[model samples]
Target: MTTAIAGRIEIVSDAICPWCWIGKAHLDGALELLAAEGLAFGLGWLPFQLNPDMPEGGVDRRAYRTEKFGSWERSQQMDAQVADAGRVAGVEFRHDRMARTPNTVEAHRLIRLAGVDGVQHATMDRVFRAYFNEGQDIGDRAVLGALGREAGMAAPTLEAFAAGDAARAEVVAESRALAQAGINGVPSVLLDRHLLFSGAMPAERMADGIRRAVAILRDRAA
Candidate 1:
């Protein structure tokens, strides 16, 4: 069966970004509204590492966040703020369960592979849930392989993909390119090469942006 797509949407984000997850949910809501209007899109998940210099295994979440945020109390407050926003987006954030902030390069590479397997959305969702809600270590190869398997990918294929560096350099390069392009944030969404708004915007606002982008794209084509 073939699906009729109006255009392609590329979302540049990191695997461990809570705001990116919330942005995805809002984007899903926007798509649902657009679907009712007979509009559809193909999604592309791009890589943007929030912590590209972190160690391979990663550091303790409390220690890392404390140092980054200036104190444990400040970090908790920030997490609470994000949690409150997440609740409005229908996302469950288990910040209390999150212990370690894992390096997400491997996870980003897997997302690239998932795109080829036609399960990128599901794989991204799985990674988000694993890190945010389930508090699982996304940097672990075994866990990533299991996530791929759950997303309908073959275990053997995932194992081989994990054992070597296939999309590693590509992911890093893409992330660097995005940074060089002056996009230093996650959840930077682009539709048909037209950059939409950034941040976890409301569904209605997102829909409006998409509508405007579609109109501009059609005008350009015309």
Candidate 2:
């Protein structure tokens, strides 16, 4: 029932990235389509903070964007562009509902714990949905606990994350290492530990990339 094309896929992304969401949809579609054609893969999500300097609680999105982009209109333009891409990717991005841009350290902490619970991907999806769809502030422990519940994580597991006593240093270290290695972008997928490509590629393009990667690996094996 499995295929020789099976391999590991690591996605370096952030939960708040609209393009990352779009990239995930494309990669997921590629995986499903390829699985039907005898390819398989194990997926892992890695952490990257867009606003590493954000406070533990977070700040107002409007103020943050205005400071970062130099103008409210420019920020609006970028959001509109992301929203247009979201439409094409089947993501109903509710940017209007988001008031604050969260620190995301807490959210990443939750994701790290979810991996131990064997619900990392589910938790990641729930986090993205909670933020981009439901406008939930994922930086809060209460919101994270609710997302953990929705993702089927155990009660104690969620509680442990809420206490902020778990996976904090590991997440911080890994994030720093990746940044030092020059991975400063989201939707960056690595196939078998080698950089495949970056950006929100179309599903067909991703499938082609996967096929090529498998072929290259096979050649190396021979």
* Highest-scoring model, TM-score: 1
What lDDT does each candidate get?
0.89, 0.87
Residues 70-134 of candidate 1: C-alpha lDDT, one tens digit per residue: 99999999999999999999999999899999999999989988877788888998889989999
- Provide the lowest-lDDT 10-residue window in model 1: 152-161
Residues 1-222, model 2: lDDT tens digits: 656547898889887888988898888888888888888888788888888888989889899999999998999999999889888878888888998899888888888899877888788888988898888998888988899889989988988887756988888888888889989888899998888998999998998998899889989989
| Per-prediction TM-score | 0.96, 0.95
Displacement of the residue 78 alpha carbon in candidate 2, Å:
1.0
Model 2: runs farther than 4 Å from truth?
1-5
Q: What lDDT does candidate 2 reach at residue 168?
A: 82
Cα miss at 12, model 2 (Å)?
Answer: 0.4
- After superposition, the stretches of candidate 1 with alpha carbons farther than 4 Å from their true spots are 1-4
